[model samples]
Target: MLPLTRDQKHLVDQILAFTTDHVNETGPAVFTVYGDAGTGKSVILAHLFNQLQTAARTQPNSPLTQTTNYFLVNHPEILKVYREIAGQAPHLLKKDFQRPTTLINQLAKGQTTADVLVIDEAHLLLSQSDHYNNFYGDNQLRSLLTAAKVIILVFDETQVLRMKSYWTEERLERLLMPYPHQHVRLTHQFRMQASDALVTWINDFTHGHVHHLPKDIGTHYDLRIFNDAEQMRQTIVAKNNQVGLSRIVSTSGYPSTLDGGKHYITEGHFHLPWDQYNYTSTPWAELPQTIDEVGSIYTCQGFDLNYVGLILGPPLTLSPQDQLEVHLDRYTDVEAFKRRADITDKQELIAVKKQLILNAVNVLMKRGVQGLYIYAHDAHLRQFLGAK
Candidate 1:
């Protein structure tokens, strides 16, 4: 279960008020919660959603009573966690939690409209039609707004990972221009135990700015650069054994395909299969056996870990000028950079691909709550990070 901070609790109350005001409005109403990864965005949504359901089901005097609501997440892994939590709550039903695509398709079939729809990972909602996912709508959020009275969503532009689902503040605002909307940005780093300086170091590094590692950085966080990949894996295993929820994750340079076969990440006699498509209810990071597999951005995003061993893959390298360089050809995730007709400029498309790669790096780095371990496939980059 997720716990809300004092500020998060207040935010929930504010969102509840926003929902109450917009419940009776004729057009679509939007309340967006903006925060970087680990600022307790999801926790606020959890509490707010629970309150909505409770007031709707148990309090006849409440305006929310008799309201039909739904909780949506585009990520299947996160959706599984929500549904599992719903199974234990008397006020929330498993059916109340669904993928955005699933809900959009259902509403398109002339199903009952939702009085309130709460969306998590709103950045993952498709901006363009994805026939593979069975979402042929022009835009998922637009379709949802048409089908729901009030929509509350959480978004972080840095978490936008695909060309199809790509979003920025400007893009989102342009879409919400016609709707009655309210938004707030949360700045605290709730997920990482590290100091602000450390967080800045991470942000800078992902942005291709390499600075010397801070001398006092290890005071609160266990930040380490490993010279050997196998040694790093061993250390992560030890961390998992001691405290649990630690896993080795990597960026997308290795050989990966949609084929139902295993591909291995081989580094200095250390070999592990890429994370398998999880068919079970458990999140990938929580499973004990996942330690033997190398996780990618897909399975590990939106989850927290006690320790993260991140392998900066081959696509990421150090330039002769000592800056970070991302080689697009080395990136194996073709689906992430798929061509979109709207993106006609070649340089703009290339820049977006590189930024998405950096975004993946940012996501993996922030997953560790207590510690972060690093191993780079590029020797110069590893040597630079390992420098005293």
Candidate 2:
């Protein structure tokens, strides 16, 4: 078992105290665990759940004896599948899996009575304005709080990807002020190399704060920025084959054309290739032939590998005034158009976009145990890396 970090242990103790105290009083307790992406929020929750399960089994009358339900608000389809497997009534799953209102209503119905409700991706519950008409109704965080005796919401407000209404710290505090809750924060990062300067740079750029790490005590990462696509491809292939490292390519625009030779010959993989461009797949696979086969930044967020090669597509160009415009356009749907429209200032939008790219880059960079290879088309970005 991986030893829990100090923050993790503190979180667990707090949860235990909250649960025990609430159960003794026969009341509900709301707890929010906030942290940045890759801060091991889910891991801590899982560990706590396991401990609660063990305690429930050993002491049947324990306050944590209420059925534990762990739900991720991001993917509703998976929840549907789980409901089916659990033999739950169809109506139970109808509660807007994405919305806090639906979740609260469902929990209140007593069909799924959970003593401890663990909500992952709680950042998805920004505010009333942050939601779509089809999903969240009224307030999501407030609705979720109404559901369970011990509600554990794990999220990072700074990592809010989709903006319904603009969110600020003042707004978030007001939203949570009504609840009798304890706010716990996790700071230690177990995944990244302690000495990694890029991690510091990216975090500082994104959050406007610096996260200090020990000097590269372990394997130092090599940063390479390239402008030529072919040259970048060649370098990634050589690195992957020679060192058995995984390669990832990120693009803002779907490639209009894909080189078949590079797709099959190179061991490195691409992210969301099918979504970006048209490609023919080989006989063995059902999906189109694209770098998405290797992995995507979304799929690989909390994961780590021996090596990572990142390719930034056109959207990441230094010249684009609306840097995050491409990212928001690519990730969200048409319904989110109004939210994007609210972003009026080009420079502010570009700054947000830059932060988004830096976050994505941070995600890719931390994946490598020993090395990171970057291929960027933007000349400014290349210059930033001091690449030849």
Which candidate number has the best TM-score?
1
How far in Å is the alpha carbon of 214 misplaced in model 1?
2.1
My TM-score estimates for the predictions, one after another, are 0.98, 0.68
Error of 2 at 137 (Å): 1.2
For model 2 the TM-score comes to: 0.68
Candidate 1: give the clashing pairs. none
TM-score of structure candidate 1: 0.98
Candidate 1 Cα deviation (angstroms), residue 171:
0.2
Residue pairs in collision within model 2: 254-276, 270-291, 270-292, 324-353
The regions of model 1 sitting more than 4 angstroms off are none
lDDT of 1 by residue, 314-375 (tens): 99999888889999999999899877888899999999889999989999999999999999
- Give the Cα error of residue 388 in candidate 1, in Å: 8.5
